[model samples]
Target: MSAPSVPPQSDGGQSGRPGRKPGPISDGVGPTHRAWLEPLRTRFLAGGLTISDLSERSGWAKSKISELLRGAGLYPRWEITHGLLQVLEIPTWPMRRLWMAAALEAHKKPDWIDGCIQKVALTTGPVEPPLEHQAFTDLNRDAYTAYARVFLEDQEAFEAVQETFDLLWLHWHEALASSDVVAFAWPVLRERVMDRAYHSEDGHPELTHAAFNTLALSHLTDDDARFRQIAESLALFRAISRLPAPQLDVMVLTHLLGLDHAAVADVLGTPIAAVHSTDRYARKSLTTVLGPQHDPGDAPA
Candidate 1:
């Protein structure tokens, strides 16, 4: 929570890559985290909370707070970071959610995460920004939001859509030759969100440090009443986002996006039976999360 002691001359002692070191800086703060928190640091300083003041308020040992902000090769605790957000007096729950997501995503690569952040951050513009990225968001933006909305918050959802468009942008010629942008792009978009939502480097959580554990951000519980209400309510957006990462891809593809079981399987690169099982589990989990209002059978199970 301590404000970064960044002088005007430097980008907080990190002109380009914030926590980057010589020769790749193994486990350093990636671009996504730096992009996400740099603004917070600026606002924190603007609010007149000096580094010492934030350190005092966070009540975290100076070392812990520094580690959190510097964010060198750590997954970051929801409890600790959320506490700092509270102390910093950052406005809005969405921003907190963004921080939570970026922190979580930051544990991996920065390129995609930072790209998604930029996309969501630029909401309320172009349907699809042109090829040069000079104007307009792009036509495929809607498709990303529609599918990605399942795995991400509203803001992140939009960014996910943009990421999908980024794929479309990359493979424009291939898609043209394939004569099916849907087939070509959907698989890429679907897997991108899925891998980011779940799977770590080895399809399992990697131990970053002994003292701290990587807390998976998905899964709903009684403790999530506020967010759960958002899940339960008619807000289709929140409902999808609240589901566990695995369930989200299946449910969103099979239900919300109107893809059939086989199509879901294709997008997931799994068998038809696996898709059905995932779909059933997702609906059942929704029933539990929604508790009475939702009927698992209402889904294709």
Candidate 2:
């Protein structure tokens, strides 16, 4: 372990205050990250420590210390921030919360954050993730992955779910603070999946990619019949994707992911009634968009 940085002493070998404080944090530092940065700056100034002192004491480069103080350059990893906080005698618990909130705001992946924290060992001990977080991940990982797989390849879908869980873990406290954890966490998962979803020219997630892979097309042996099925399937996919988010989610969870209405309700943290209503709206809207079928039973399941 590194020796704690000592504040310069006064004329009588008493602790002396720094002559000047560090400059104001730039406006560019986001509010969440700035919240954490301010205390580090305040503690450093109060300790009468110089950049060189922090650098030497923490075993960090002088340039790194300067950037951290000035809020310049890329957002730093938790490992470096934690080390500096220790050297400055700041309580890690409070700053850890603030650091996490900032990290979430920075849009870092969970693995990236975890890898960074693991890089540096601290006497305070390794960071323990919240216990409920593990439970949450276990419960929802498969459902989220299944939903994501509708639009993404298997590995991409898995990665999207992984990122979502990581984000939820990072903001676990905030998620708990919200009216409903599902309400908060679902949007995070949805955003992660949609970010990697295929988008049409207007930037909406469109299912045009899934059109050719339908079971209906596989059953059609004639070239003309297959081509017609392809066209209708394309139209259906576009309609399904263009539905409002709630309706679209219900359709995907129920029809595409093979989850039941109760299961969809459970996953979305919504009432069964809401899921049923949304499903009705989605099917009705599809019917409206595609026009009434001569034989409703012939519609693709």
Best by TM-score: 2
Q: How would you encode candidate 1's per-residue C-alpha lDDT over 106-224 as one tens digit per residue?
A: 55356544544454332222344345432223534554566665445566556555444443443354455664445556665654455444334445321122101112213335567
TM-score of each: 0.33, 0.62
Root-mean-square deviation of candidate 1: 16.9
Question: TM-score for model 2?
Answer: 0.62
Q: Least lDDT summed over 10 consecutive residues: which range in candidate 1?
A: 205-214
Error of 2 at 32 (Å): 18
Q: Which pairs of residues collide in candidate 2?
A: none
Q: Would you give me the overall lDDT of model 1?
A: 0.50
lDDT values, one for every candidate: 0.50, 0.72
- Evaluated with lDDT, which candidate comes out highest? 2
Per-residue lDDT over 1-301 for candidate 2, one digit per residue giving the tens place of the 0 to 100 score: 1111223223234365564455778778864565557657766876666787778778888887788888888788777798897777665654666676567677888787778767866565226557887888889888998888878888768766866665565456667877877767787788768866878887778776566765678788999999888888777778888888898888878876667899998899899999989988888898898887522224343
